[model samples]
Target: MADDIVFDLLHSEIINYALEQTKTTNGSKEVDLSVVEYIGFAAGYKIMERLTREWPRFKDELDTMKFICTDFWTCIYKKQIDNLRTNHQGVYVLQDNAFRFLTNFSNGHQYLEYAPRYVAYTCGLIRGGLANLCINSIVTAEVQSMPSCKFHIHVQRT
Candidate 1:
């Protein structure tokens, strides 16, 4: 319990530091979270390598997504995805009723404007994790309410 709180605090601080660094460097009104996302991407790619070291090779794309929805999400967020939807056409949506990052904020839409900054890293994390698995994807997030968030994964077939 205490460890979780510490982790959350550290995560929040990292995001805040990244935002501060971006503001200082760019000196512009636009908030570019690409740096944060890229950091997440790199972290995800490396973490995935370690996480899957002892696991068997995935049989298909669906299997890989399952790993993300279950093991990967759980490993990082400490909870399994609440819902996962797919269109059989290379699109997958993973919903979390209580996203770890957002859960610390209000449950209402008070902080809606800042949700993007919070989710950017996670979006990159998902993308990076998939990339490490040899699956090219564009990961995006939709936050309707504060704590609940949905991540959309578009698998690129090339």
Candidate 2:
């Protein structure tokens, strides 16, 4: 519980600060999202380094990604991912019905506007995790409402 709170606080502050900085710099939502994602990417790389040091090596690309969906997501959010789907063609979707960072987010009118920031951060985290495992991929996040987010991952088929 304490860790969860700290994570929430730090995530919120980072996102808010990034948005503010982006506004002053490029004033583009896309730019802000990129900035946040970059931060997540760095974090994801560090996390993967720490988590994988003692774990068994991944068997394949899918296994590494599955680790992100299950182990990585759980470690950060304190909950397993709600759903994982793949076409076995390098495309994957991981859904979380109650994503931690957005659980208490309730901006009502600004919900649509503000939700993307958090989602983008998550996308970066997933992308970074995959990248750390040597899987080049594009990850994206979409939200239908607060605490409900879907992450889409696309790995380059080797």
Candidate 3:
């Protein structure tokens, strides 16, 4: 309980710090969260290295995605993804009905505009984790409403 709150607070502070750095560096109204995302990417890559050290090799792409939706997510957010959808064509969607970061605030559309900032890190986290596993992908988050966020992963087949 208390640990979750502390984690949430730290995450919020990190986002705000990244946003401020971006604004200062760009010197304009433009919002660039690449730095924040990259931070997540590095973290995710390293974490994945540790997490998978003892695990068996994944059989397929779907197996990898399942690991992300369950173990990876649980390690970071303390909850397994609520749902995962795929087209079986190199695209996957991971949904969390009560996204940890967003749940700290309103449950509705009150902070919808700022949802992207909260999710940018997570987007990169997913991408980096996949990259570490040798899966090239672009991860993005969609927030149609508050507290519930969907992450779309597009695998780039080369």
Which structure among the candidates has the greatest TM-score?
3
Q: lDDT tens digits, residues 42-80, model 1?
A: 999999989898889899899999999999999999999
TM-score of each: 0.95, 0.89, 0.96
lDDT of 3: 0.91
lDDT by residue for model 3 (3-98), tens: 778978888899889889888888998888898899889988888999998889999999999999889899899999999999999999999999
lDDT of 2 by residue, 1-158 (tens): 67559878888898888878878887665545688898888888778889888879789877877788777887888888999899999899898888887777663334766788777777888778778888889988887766678888888766
Model 1 accuracy (lDDT, Cα): 0.91
RMSD of each: 1.2, 2.2, 1.0
Look at candidate 1 and give me any clashing residue pairs: none
State candidate 3's TM-score: 0.96
Model 2, position 111: C-alpha lDDT score: 73
| Candidate 3 stretches greater than 4 Å from native | none
lDDT of 1 at 154: 94
* Candidate 2: stretches off by over 4 Å: 27-31, 107-110
**Residue 65 shift from truth in candidate 2, angstroms:** 2.0
